[model samples]
Target: MTATLMTGTDLAAEMVAKAADRARALQERTGVQPCLATVLVGDDPASATYVRMKQNRSKKAGIGSRSVVLPAETTTEDLVAELTKLSEDPAVHGILLQHPVPAQIDERAAFEAIDPAKDVDGVTTRSFGAMAFGEPGFRSATPGGIMRLLEAYDVPIAGAHAVVIGRSPILGKPVGMLLLASNATVTYTHSRTTDLPAIVRTADIVVAAVGRANFLQGDWLKPGAVVVDAGYNEGNVGDVDFAAAAEVASLITPVPGGVGPMTIALLLEQAVDAAEAQTA
Candidate 1:
């Protein structure tokens, strides 16, 4: 049986519409538009495009956008200082630091500079801990989006065996934690994982977040396993071999339209939530 596609475009749009309504209401009540501050370092074309896309979506959601572009040679201290300033800004409800800042900057250090209250992208250590403990707090945007997508499609999560093919702090690790919180048994694998395909075959659900294009083959999937491709490599290719995996898996998410849109939608929605909480 051919796999049914789990398209996130429509769901993301619905979520964005709801966020826009909330943003409007918040503005009406407080005279303050929910704002999202984005920090970008260097001139990576791909990162620039992602930042632009987020800013544009924020506008559509009735959220104000503050863009901070730092030089490629910026030191870690400077970046931290900038993040701290944004964190303390009462008008800014959410702060997102585009990933892969630069080789020179201490990425984790900069992430820590963002106040947990304004960490809408959920990169801070506190946010990660909160998510791990299933406590109330902002989730890492992409993982949060992935959970929403799974729920929207009515995919059974609890008690399922989920193999996550990455261990990145933001995407892979957190997604696995979320699945565990949903009662799914989680196995995390990284580049060092031996017999990766064999592990994948045992999963009821497979999340490909290794950042490699077409890294997971179709033969690796169980006949009815659900696939969520969270990788967006060069040329829009995903971690899974989409065409091949679709022939075997029961459900799959495509690149570009799957996790990407949902991520931005959740970021905007969380920004609105932060605004309301801070004001209240």
Candidate 2:
């Protein structure tokens, strides 16, 4: 069956509109605006574009945004200090540090510096713990967006055999946990896995987040499986070979128009949520 596409662009637009209303209501009631602060270390063009997209979306949603661009040679301590400052600022409701920081910088340390209360992008230890424990807390934007897209498409998550490829803390690990919380049998695979294709062929839901281009082939998918490609590689290729996978899978999320828009949508939603919680 040619897979029915799960388009994130449409859903993201709806979610963003709701976030805008929420932002307006919060501003009207408490006179406090929801604000997100993005910290960028180094001058990575892709990261810069991602940050700009977020900022532009925030403006449309009525969420204020501030950017802190640091040199590529920034130290971990300096980056952490900047994030901490944003955490402590009453005006800032959320903090996001663009990923793939300089080699010398400790990314996790910088992530931890964002206060749990303002961790709208949800990259901190606290947020992960909350997600793992199924507690009420923010989620990393991309994974959260992936889950929302699945639900929006009415995919049956419970009891599904889900194979999540990759082990990244923010993407694969957390997405697996979220799926487990939804009652899916989750298996996480990495580069070291023996015969990865064999494992993927058994899954009813496949989440490809391994950061490689066309790593998962269409032949690996179980017929009628639900495919979610979360990879954003250079040249706009995803971990899964979308053209091939779509030919077999019953449902699939396309690259660029799939997970990307939903990510910013959730971030804006969480920023508004954080602001409302802070004011309440």
Candidate achieving the largest lDDT: 1
Alpha-carbon lDDT, every model: 0.95, 0.93
RMSD of 1: 0.7
lDDT of 2 at 65: 94
What stretches of model 2 exceed 4 Å from their correct place? none
TM-score of 2: 0.99
Candidate 1, 247: how far from true, in Å? Answer: 0.4
lDDT string, candidate 1, 1-280, tens digits: 4999998999999999999999999899989999999999999999999999999999988999999999999999999999999999998899999989899999999999999999999888899999999999999999999999999989999999999999988999999999999999999999899999999999999999999999999999999999999999999899999999999999999898999999999999999999999999
**RMSD in angstroms, candidate 2?**
0.8
lDDT (10s digit) by residue, model 2, range 124-176: 98999998899999998899999999999999999999999998989999999
- Return the lDDT, model 1, position 118: 94
